[model samples]
Target: MSPNTSAGSKQHLAHSHAHEEDIPGTVNLNAAEGDDTGYGQALFPVPAEDPNDPLQWSNFKKTMILIICSFYSFLANAALIGPSPYIDLWAEEFDISPTKASELISYPNLAFGFGSLIFVPLYLKIGRRPVMLISLIIFCAGIIGASQCTTYGGLMAARVIHGFGSCVCEALPVQLVNDIFFLHERGERIGYYTVCLCLGTFASLPAGYILAGGYGWRLFFYVEFAFGAALLVLAFLFVEETSYDRKSAILMSMPATESEKASEVMGSQVLAEISETRIPPRKSFAKTLSLWGRVDNDVPFFTMMARSFTYFLVPQALWVIASFGINIGLLALAYSYTFPILITSPPYNWTVINSGLFAIAAVVGYALAVPFTSSSDRLAAYFTKRNNGIREAEMRLGVMLPAMLIGPAGIILYGVVAEKSLHWVLYFVGGALSYFAAYFYFSFTLAYAVDSYHSNTSEMLIAMNLGKQYVLPNIALILPL
Candidate 1:
């Protein structure tokens, strides 16, 4: 069992999974003839008799949705962590200590998680499309505001605004994957989102080069603003409301078989069947771009925020929170905060401009891990087949074993290298190895959590956001850096 999953909590989680088909992730993969809409298997969460259903969207449209949301994830995270090298710069400019300047990044990171508290509920209640666009607009406003700020307080305020607004990027992509994709496709698609989210760290590389190019950190925010605006345009055009109600679904008729297709009588019969089914027409382009989208009148907003905290009691959710928090705070931020300080000071002093170079470790780590994005999904599918089409969330747990061990080793190597001031390459090597291993944890833990809580994923995301960013970072900040 992967340490990320709690074996002891299985009995505790029974109530959550009890309502689903047998188990939480369990689904019947066996379909009647001509009913296979999946990978030659039965489609889980079967599509309603409507073109408007997100599941029934065309592949190109689906890909576009994925692209836009993944891009949002990238921009949000880039804006969050890209300013690491500037901790010292901001300290000097604002006449504050480096630790105080770090709060510019840290406070925003807190807002990033806290933003999910409101936005997740908002998206759940109002629909993903409008919430996404509104969030991007808020994010863009904050980024541009940061570009023009001079005081530490003003900049911090702006940073918090953007962080909070953009944070919905994290929740939306995961929610979209669940909204649009089927069970067989979850791991791979979530992996793709994870790669983009990870690559956001790669923003530090360019942020450094911008400084090297004689531009101040403000230009970095300006650059982010530019991309944020462009993403807004894309989102406005393409991201339709994905909130769907499947409770009253009508079963769609299966496609005609070969023998039926060969018969004119059956062909006419199929046409009549389709006509009688009354599938709604696809929304018009103008309508798709409208500000008004889905609204769940029944989803109580504040109650959802209160209930989200309850998910913290669940083991799978806690695992995601702890792992993500440790990776982001202890691993990602530690490197980001320390690399510049170490590189620009005594003993192998390098130019301040090269401080962000360590991000390449993260880039390379995620690159090496990207190809295996779908491995867990494939593994689970294989297991589901073997088990007579009954799928389990734990099936993906096996792939996390190697990463679980290697990750700790990398963390140890990093600590030793930092303590001894070992060769700089070893530091990066540790970062790379740790991050490479973390990529699996980042991708699969989330996939597994979503699989485990097929019904209440929003609450799980709320716990993840709050625990990782709000809860862990505050505790981590108290430690001596």
Candidate 2:
């Protein structure tokens, strides 16, 4: 397909071909169809002539948007799970079973995942910034509602509302990260976000202790409410649209052809061209917020949603499922939930007040593992360079070998400790070891997926997000503690 056949005037090219490798660019959708779009213009996913594609943005812009959105994920997760310590209080006040009280966390968690089914494609279609800002507003209202609720149903509804809104933060950050980052840079960046998301457990330890200090469980809600409100303001002021033309890679990869030939090749490409000539000319905060800043009408909300489901067939997506499920199921759910409950009762007899202290072990473990967070990226990049610029997606998995053995060993030790009533310190040691090992699996799995599937990062993210949600809740509630 020739570039001119696309409907819109060419504003920019796709970033897939921007990297410094050959046989290296994304899978060219246009080239696959044997189009004659200029080799310089072909993009990986091969956007039509639109400039609004998320893939075309500068690294700094993408990074800022990613960091903000990922932090939003961190906060939203914290709000839902942080109140676990207060579940007993809620149970006592409402005269509900411990399991029912736990629903405050579990049901919201389910909502958290399902929310993505609704919003992921919307953001992919409509643009990330607008969806994010709107979601944050709804999230804020949900938090405020939870703070005011006096009944179990009211609180549960509020929690569901909050979880649903917050779910976007999780999926969107990964999607945005996939959208903008290069294969070499993605692992470390996603690792950073995953750290924040995982630390919700560690953060909740102290969140629980706050109740023992007499602030009461309601204070936790208040604290989360305050942070949500602040994050909302920050997002509105800082986030910009992230969707962009998907054609540059295809145009860039194919050899150039005459204009007449290009027109014959691009039958559907013209339909994809965006009408906007410029991106609202990067403006100041006040100007950016004005209703005058036009929204793109070409947003393909439903199409984006429909396409995301196809990620299940991608190999990288399965790896993400295994990596994310094992890491979160083990460290976040199995270890984090079980250790506290076990140590606080039976032979250990530790007080509920101090049960949350074990999260310190988890934090320490992950902290120790932090130095190695970028090892996968470095190793993959090094190997990619060694191959004379031929990039294979599996290069990063070697760095995870050490983690695979170490994590399962920690699990065994924890099981023994719980079964035999060993010293409580063994619990800490085992949990710490598992958490440290999980760092590698959690960090690199995502990088591998991003590198492997060069075209659709959002699709992979959707799968990973859903995987985490399904695994965490099942392990946390159904399996044991």
Candidate 3:
């Protein structure tokens, strides 16, 4: 009582202490007297102090990686679909029915989807680089295997192996782009990647003629094998591991490695105290490749998978209907199946390999889309800022509206031209129009889904990829093709 009363009696001392403690721009709340509503919080939580945060990656670094990965996807997918024009040749050579020979493409596609079930999870657990490198090796091996195969069964097995390996390319790029880019940036970046992917379709068309140019079908696989091997080596050197824990950036600044437990202990204590904060941490290329990152202990893989299923229930998700339907319908079925037959059959009487010209249409379509590649991102960002830093999930949809009409129109035109045996230019024009329209939908819708459902992107991509890929070729495209 003597000491406490003496301190209380020192009014000037107390006032000075109180004045010093009451600093400007500071908030003081009595936790014991009020409910903790977490009113004082950042609008967007800054990433934890992790050097390995994808956000910490430089724009140029991210772009290079994106380009490489997208290119791999383009080559792998091109290799798979490029051989569609050779179906007639396979049928004749193997002495199998065209229906039987078509199984070469269909069965491999099935393997493509299932390969994700293994590789996607493994990438999440191990690191994207390792899985991608392994996949490229397998892809090259499969291509080499296919080049040597003499029997239809052997060729089918080799194609399946290659399809399985290429499957990771689809998931990894979307995942990597998501990992590195922001909400506003996703549409354009994805658009760029989508264009590369679509170009693969065109690139493969030339392979049909390559088969006809005296090199045979074996040359197509051999050429693809060389590209796949080159990409594999590039991936091992460039596509480093991306998994990281963001919480340990502070205590680990001593130029010494810290245990995960120590990092977590300090991170939790500091996190509990900060009401509003900004984090800056040391960065390095090596950190980007570490298989450790900030843990969101709240989320689990199965929970993430479960939550992503709800995206399929969304309206915009459903709206992708006509775009993907028509695009895949035309590329895989109409152009892939029909063009080859039409070009090689009666009136047209074109060579069996000339079926690849449809790919030129695909190329023209994608190239035309180049100017507008940045439009969606810019539009979304503008609208987001106008909304006072609030980003609506649907704002990006505006850019896609133009595409809706464009894609459907292309499909109808292509259908009519094919039905009437119209001039081949009409086919290319219709295909380009349809392909360009589909490009907007692919990039924007994917960006929308990623933004609306920020968590569990990989799982959503899995469902999306598996569902569309399986259903389109099997059901919708099959009818038209």
Clashing pairs in 3: 244-292, 244-293, 244-294, 245-292, 245-293, 245-294, 246-294
| Model 2: per-residue Cα lDDT over 401-445, one tens digit each | 888888888889989989999998988888888988888777777
The residue ranges of model 3 lying beyond 4 angstroms of the native Cα positions read 1-51, 92-95, 247-311, 314-326, 340-352, 416-422, 476-481
> lDDT at 209 for candidate 2?
70
TM-score against truth, every candidate: 0.87, 0.79, 0.77
Off by over 4 Å in 2: 1-63, 246-310, 345-347, 419-421, 476-478
Clashing pairs in 1: none
Candidate 1 local Cα displacement, residue 167, angstroms: 2.1
Tens-digit per-residue lDDT, 1-481, candidate 3: 0101233432110000001013221222211221111121111212333434654455556777898899998998887777876778899999999989989987887788767766776677666777777888888889999999999999999999999988988888988887766444577888889887777766555775685577788888888888888887666656756555533543443232233246466685564344113334445556545444333444455655555457567565555534454567656565666777777776678875566667778778878888898787677656655654445667678988888788889888988987888887888898889878878877777777766555566776766766667557655534754
Which candidate leads in TM-score? 1
Clashes of 2: 26
The alpha-carbon root-mean-square deviation between model 3 and the true structure, to one decimal in Å, is: 12.2
